[model samples]
Target: MLDVEKSVLYVAFGSLAEITIDQFRELAMGLENSGVHFLWVMRIPFEDEFLNEFEERVKGRGVLVKNQWVDQVEILRHGSVSGLMSHCGWNSVLESICESVPLLGFPITADQYWNARMVEDYYGVGVKVLTDTGSVRGFFSSECIANKVKELMNVECVKGKEIRENVKKLKGRGAAARSAMEEGGSSWDALDMFIDQLIFGKKKK
Candidate 1:
């Protein structure tokens, strides 16, 4: 289903989010209305009546993975995945960064709010889906959800282009950081210094 290049939007809210059925329905309808191809990782069982109808409605345009363990990294790395709708968990944020995929932040709790803010305000690599109110667990209408998805996925838009460029640069930095952690690089040297301090009770001069 994720065969077309840069055409799939990957949606996952992480495992800890406590989303209501109504909210899930809103998300489902929003994705269906967005007209963008998507792969949704649903925590709820597929046997649920609402999901069964949603799957049938979006059969050709979406793939729903329900109540199962999925290799999220593999999905993000796929050529077809262009954008991520995430709960902004630290791990998910880093995975999206390493893959160079831009995010549509839907943060739930803890450090996720900060992560979402950084993604949008600090890094310029993503957008946040704001609620009508200022509450942490505020609800959003299906229309708002659809609009945000369209804004992120519409490559022809200026914001979309900017996000793409920002993510590209970030990906380069991530590659450099990975290289720096290898045997003889700067990160390796720093780690060695810390380990030496721990063992010898003396800081490197």
Candidate 2:
């Protein structure tokens, strides 16, 4: 992990989304094939023999955290973390943007699809991992996962660089948002006004 700068990829699908053991196998194989250092935080508890073997094979380069709660923000903030392979839930998208870490979106269900599009198409801070059938949401192959991981981690490439730059810009905007909530900022002023109204009742007019 220390061999490279901004070389690690962090992967997590939200707890709400359920994935089968087969999908997990593909993700493991793909991350290994990508040859990128990765930390995958999984909510599912897979007590499978194959997972044990897979972990040993990718021992030094990849880490699998199963059925555990990790401090996701802390992981994203690490200097070695370059990208997040995520389900593109709204909170995950915002966290990636705030940390300036580029995203490799793998939206599964519900509003995740919309959020993934916003990350990829609208904000341009991420790239979507498409299925074998070229659909945005569905079962995806290990090859597809490998290709997308490589694409996101390839900083020398045009697309990867563009996404990195975009995420940086988005992170700046997030900073500005924080400032807006500080004292004397617009959000502060609005909240002050609201509190005054609640305490005094409509300003007597």
Candidate 3:
């Protein structure tokens, strides 16, 4: 379904997000309104019937994967996936960073809010959706979702450019950290120290 190269927005709400039906509809509408190509991973209990009309409306531009387990890392690494709309789970955030893709954070609960803040505030790699007034987990309007998606994907926008640059730099740092675990590197030295401590304890026994 993701045929285009670097042209699709990839969306998933992790494994535990409890989205109300209304909120789901709003997200569907927002994706439609965004006018960008997308690949949405829908969890079970949400039937294709719920989005039949939406699918029909966005036939050529959108692809929906329903009630199926997918290799998220593979899809994120694909050239067709340009951005991620995620629940800001740490694993998802790191995956996006490693792949050098920007984010559209829709955090639900737990540490997700903090992750979202880090993405937008600390890391400068994403934007968060606004919650409804007077409600902690209330629905955000489709318009807000559409606008944020557009802003994040707009290459000419300052924020978009910053996010791209930030993720690129972060990816480089991650690569260096991984390389540090090789022979004669700092991480290798730390591992050797840990092993020596274990051996010393055994000898004392």
In order of appearance, the predictions have TM-scores of: 0.83, 0.83, 0.81
Cα lDDT tens digits, model 2, 19-103, are 7788878888889889999988887647878888988998988887888888888888889899999999877877778788999
lDDT per model vs. reference:
0.86, 0.85, 0.83
Instruction: Kindly give the number of clashing pairs for every candidate.
Output: 0, 0, 1
Tens-place lDDT digits, model 3, residues 1-205:
5698877899998878888788898899999999999999987546657688888998899988887888988898898888999999877887788778899999888988888878888889888887656222557899888988888887788988888888888888766654565687677777787787797853211
- On TM-score, the leading prediction is 2
Model 1 over residues 116-159: C-alpha lDDT tens digits? 88898999989987777743357867877898899999999999
TM-score of candidate 2 relative to the true fold: 0.83
Which ten contiguous residues of candidate 1 have the minimum total lDDT? 132-141
All candidates in order of lDDT, best leading: 1, 2, 3
| lDDT of model 3 at position 142 | 91
Which lDDT value does model 3 have at 138? 55
Model 2, residue 130: what's the lDDT?
88
Alpha carbon deviation, residue 154, candidate 1 (Å) = 0.5
Query: How do all the candidates rank in terms of TM-score, highest first?
Result: 2, 1, 3
Residue-level error in angstroms, candidate 3, position 140 = 1.0
Q: Whose lDDT is greatest here?
A: 1
